[model samples]
Target chain A: MHEALRFQPVDAEPVDRADVVAKSRHLRRVTEGAARGLSLTIRGLRKAFGDNEVLRGIDLHIPAGQFVAIVGRSGCGKSTLLRLIAGLDAPTAGGIAFGEQPRAQDVRVMFQEPRLLPWARVLSNVEVGLGRERSSADAQARAERALVEVGLGDKRGEWPSVLSGGQKQRVALARALVSQPRVLAFDEPLGALDALTRISMQQLLERVWRDQGFTAILVTHDVAEAVALADRVLVIEDGRIAEDVTIDLPRPRRRGSAELAALEGEILKHLLEGSEDTSGL
Target chain B: MSLIDSLPRVGAPKLPKVDGLIPWIVPLAIVLVWQLACVTGFVPSRVLPAPTDVALAGWKLLLSGELVRNIWVSFWRASIGFVIGGGIGFAFGLANGLSQLSAKLTDTTLQMVRNIPHLALIPLVILWFGIDESAKLFLVALGVFFPIYLNTLHGIRTVDPQLIEMGRIYGMTDGELFRRVIFPGALPSIFVGLRFALGIMWLTLIVAETIAASSGLGYMAMQAREFMLIDVVVLSILIYALLGKLADSASRALERLTLSWHPAFQKK
Candidate 1:
């Protein structure tokens, strides 16, 4: 029990291979099992904007309730891939299906900017994506429920204008969940917040993921964020998946823990140097 | 509490909150000065009636119910025209805002029509509709249309593209997208059009009523001018000012009601 307080200089424990292997196996099993159960299949997704060719012959599959993070340099088509999956933009070719269903509306994306309607109250903004004919009271109740899940239940009547940056993002998250979508996609949702706020938000996101089981795909530039939240981190380079690292850290992970830090360093090394072969150990 | 302690210690200087009396002071001072000048006979009565004479004329007209009748007629005509014209303008503006095809089809023609002054069309309108209430209504409608259309179109076009993309990614359909993202995004501009349309409607009504109309404040002013009833003329002008003040106040209240969620309307 005393080891829990500080195990740094006095008792620097050696890294446990059994612990790492257990965490990795557990996360991989859960995700792989979800894939088998949900049957989400992606085959050769190609997206082009004019002649830019943002996503070229890309392919990826996110299992149900699995947190997959896509990290790459800017303009590497990570955002384009997320957008295509979210149905905000149509793919030039190829297909994505949810258990043989070809519809694109099953996915929902949370943006980096909250994009809350300035005129709407926090509750209404959260209710925006709810169907039109649904009663305002129903929407409000759902929004309130979602906010409660996100730990922001008391701020229903507050205007979006007055919300802090972090609070606005929470509202956005609540909005994405209000529909109870099967697939939740995030496009660098915490990119704009301060460092402390980003860490807190990352923790909130992990907690939310734990509570609500849905397929989550996060596109981000931050290697730490990917390592902290994702079941597996996929690095996109030059319009393709360059590396897919299965995170070997246990849940409720600390930020400065040696295991996480080592994983961060390894991921950074792969990101910084292109074409590094990273076969699983 | 001492002045320094009681006063706001932040930002700009504290504006005196004479609250009730603040708005009244300038107008009251102007009236007092005018009344004093007239009472001292600094101006001839034929050229400009004393404040008392104008007040008495106002009372006589009020007693006869003519002032209220004319004001009511003008108000009804202007309001109906404003609503109809403003509605059409708002719809067109939104259409133009969202679709490039609509913009391509209507932009040049609308711009051309906007350049034609509603007053300049007075003769043509009079010829077509025969100096009747229809002509007056048409005039007001035409006058109110341009400002509302311009503002609404500007509002819709200026909506942030990033927000619209976010709405789409959130699984919002087209109608929901328009209502949630487009409409609210363009509301401040819409309000500008609404308020501008209202002001221009009042102005157009007065101008329309002035030309060959047997009833309304503008007609009364013209009739009083012919008879050299300068006090009645002054009272008519005063009535116009009062009506304008009422329209402006109502529009402002509507703006406040419609835009209460806007940051501009929020209390510090």
Candidate 2:
């Protein structure tokens, strides 16, 4: 346990522009870009818990490599939809399919909280989803590789208690990425971080997604986050998709850029107006 | 008086030091009044000896080694009984907590039997076991079982449902789920049961030995009372208190070591 503190000291540098582009290239080489154009098709995905109807026929198709953001009020079944797709929870009716595969293993979900096991070292928590059957040495290698990708390569042996909020989330991100799934689903993974940390994570995620060319769906309540990160923003209203607005902004879009701000306003107006369609945007 | 002075004393207050002696004042006053009454021929000394006489008798018993032997016997019996009862209680508690059929079938009987004091079965147990170590062990086991069983059951049932669901979602096998989620989550409560059972085991052993026993602290106390050796009885009682305190301190240390991960115990 005393040796566990060896990885405690770490420095987090912001992702450089050239590094982002190069990392994306590296990811494509590794996965052979098999994740491109992988779309999610949801058909009449209905669900009810006893007398309470949480989800009412959520239907949408996410085109491959498209970054889609789902936004909604607290009880709009937004999380339930993510859970259904991640195979964490069963749907009452209807179905969700990614390509031909239906099981949740193909899609990885990053939860809001880091949820790292207190007893496990930083690298060990990242390796947990890799299945526990592997020898310790093999698991350590895989975990170290994942941690390196997240820029925390040196902190592999440290206990998670010593990590900052941003670093812990980075570890969580590494855990999600270790599986190398085709589709990535994030349930407000950065929602709990501070303002500065949240922005940094948002940029990090955008870089990773671009590099890997994976189909990603984010569930967030922040309109700015939705507009900044998504190829298209879908508003979940009363258990249904109220609006699906495509964002025409180019890559490496700034948060307060004129184009992105205009798109944020449009999404926000639609959300607050309780509009059923994106006619204004 | 010398031993009492050896104990650390807090700083004196501005007011008279009388308050420092306040706790002992009442007991001391009562003793002084009783001794005075006895000397004045108001009450017979046979019924209640002076505190000093009791102390002198107690010192003699300690020097004779009779007190230590009795205490050792009682301690051994209690410790052995606790290990046996605690082990069985924990096993049954886990089974009943985890299984619906087992819990339903046994819960009613356990609840009923737990309410009946272990001492109440003393006559029956002695008749069946002939006042041997078996009867004493049985009494201690009976006293220990209820707390250990109930606490273990509570611990198992109280595990966070969300954690269990998380295990299932993560594709953990049933064995993995129990080991990772259920066991750790229930550990704190299980320890609670174990400690309570241990403490009760000692108490019950003393009670059992007092009623009928060839050699034990409780038997020594009863024999001292018959022979008017009040000092021996007092010495035995003090030893019992010391034994209980020792067990409690050890359990507390174990608790702290095992639950080191809890936030409340963060290392400075």
Candidate 3:
């Protein structure tokens, strides 16, 4: 039911094929004994804040290792849905279950703001991802490795205030990836970045997501970005999934390609039409 | 790139080299004018002694070790009071800031007590502890307590809720959250409170010592006034100014060291 929707193109980048395979194999080995990616099953999730129904009823089933993008207007409850899935906020009704009963450390959320501890050094901030239970030496080793993964090894000792906006986001991504989580949720993480920085961060995110093979759910308002990164694009409207479109585009998909543009246009059309209908009602 | 090369070159106005010496010029000129007035008999020497007289008085006090002894006594008293009051204030602030139950139990009472001008309680303190070291210590501690307590509470209360939420999401326990997120976030404000409390500490000490004491600089100044020793009185005032500046500088240095992660403290 999901193979056609899945885009695992072996020839995505012929030159990097060997490197990708080696990294993915190593990643699999590391996560084999540990709790790997977890599949999400959200049923009739409703969240109301003092009679303001943010999420009317959200039902989303995201399979393990699948990348999903939720796109919607400002108040269309996409963020609310993401927050519920990340377990930051509880649903007013219904339930969300993970396949393996994921621990708090097994899931991580990256917000639009980097949300780095301003007082902590870059390495320390990333080490916080290991939770308070891990040994100091082990956490330090993993944190350094995560920083190196995000191309920030040299910046380990530096303070967050010293880093540029993009660098700060990269540190945040490193922090999220340090735990080797089974589920990674992005709440418009790139929304505050500049256009150029956003694209670079998108590429970095894609590379990490592909390597880690975690269940990734990105909440974004940027249609093009949603289409470019996600295997399946979900258009949320009136706190419901208005349209579920699968982007068959292969990995390492070109930015601003005609095919991606067409998909964006199709998604935007659905979103615009849905808004109009809601307004008319 | 070299450090100097990395510095901004374009549109960066060069600072005048002579600017460093400019501050001394005004003070020196003031001193010269004062000496000239004294020499020319424009002002009575008895009423307002010349700068030289003040320096000579300082020199005499330095030789007799009286100035150093008085300063040391005052410093020790201030230090003891500051540690006691500041420590208690910090503990109370943390308690009130963290738990609503604690706040409900104590914050109102604290606010009510804070309203009573601690200096105004000097007479009561004297009556309770007598005109001894305990009276002065009590006054100084009482005076220093409010600023630290109030600012610490404000600091902890005003810490970014988002960061605290992030800490919670990251699975930090209560202790870890306080140590990592809440405490560091509250530091800048706590430092502000410390500096304010230091000023209050000195002010209270001076007043307490002057009103009833035998040894401190304030007491020495009072003694000098009784003997019509204008130079000694002026020297004591200058010493107070110096001590205040030193304390402030020390706090600022600590602020710079601890808050290096803060953008406001980062060098351009």
On lDDT, the leading prediction is 3
State, as a TM-score between 0 and 1, how close model 2 is to the true structure: 0.79
Worst 10 residues of 1 chain B by lDDT: B11-20
Model 1 C-alpha lDDT per residue in residues A40-97, reported as the tens digit of each score: 6678888887888777777677676788999988788899888877767789999777
lDDT of 2 by residue, B1-268 (tens): 3686777767843456776688678767987997688678686656656656666776776789876677678888988888788877888899999999998998889899888988899999989998899899888877888888999899989987765765665556888878877887787888898788778977898888889899998898888889886656765676777788789878888888876655654564
Write model 1 residue lDDT over B209-255, tens digit each, in one string: 88869898899999999998999989888888887888888878887
Which is the better candidate, 1 or 2, if ranked by TM-score?
A: 1
Residue B150 local lDDT, model 2? 91
| Rank ordering of all candidates by DockQ, starting from the highest | 3, 1, 2
Runs of candidate 2 with Cα error greater than 4 angstroms are: A1-38, A100-105, A132-137, A151-168, A211-213, A274-281, B1-69
User: Candidates' DockQ values?
Assistant: 0.41, 0.21, 0.73
- Write the candidate numbers in order of decreasing TM-score: 3, 1, 2
Could you give candidate 3's per-residue lDDT for residues A1-281 as a string of tens digits? 12221223222334344445445655564556234678999898899999898887888898888899999888889988888889998889989999988888889999999999999999999988888645666888888878866767778999999898989989999988888898999999999999988987888787677667789999999999999999999988888898899989876788989999999988888778824554421
Candidate number with greatest DockQ: 3
Cα TM-score of candidate 3? 0.90
* lDDT tens per residue, model 2, A129-199: 55443344676666666677667876888777778899998998887776655788899998899998888
Clashes of each: 0, 4, 0
Better of 1 and 3 by TM-score: 3
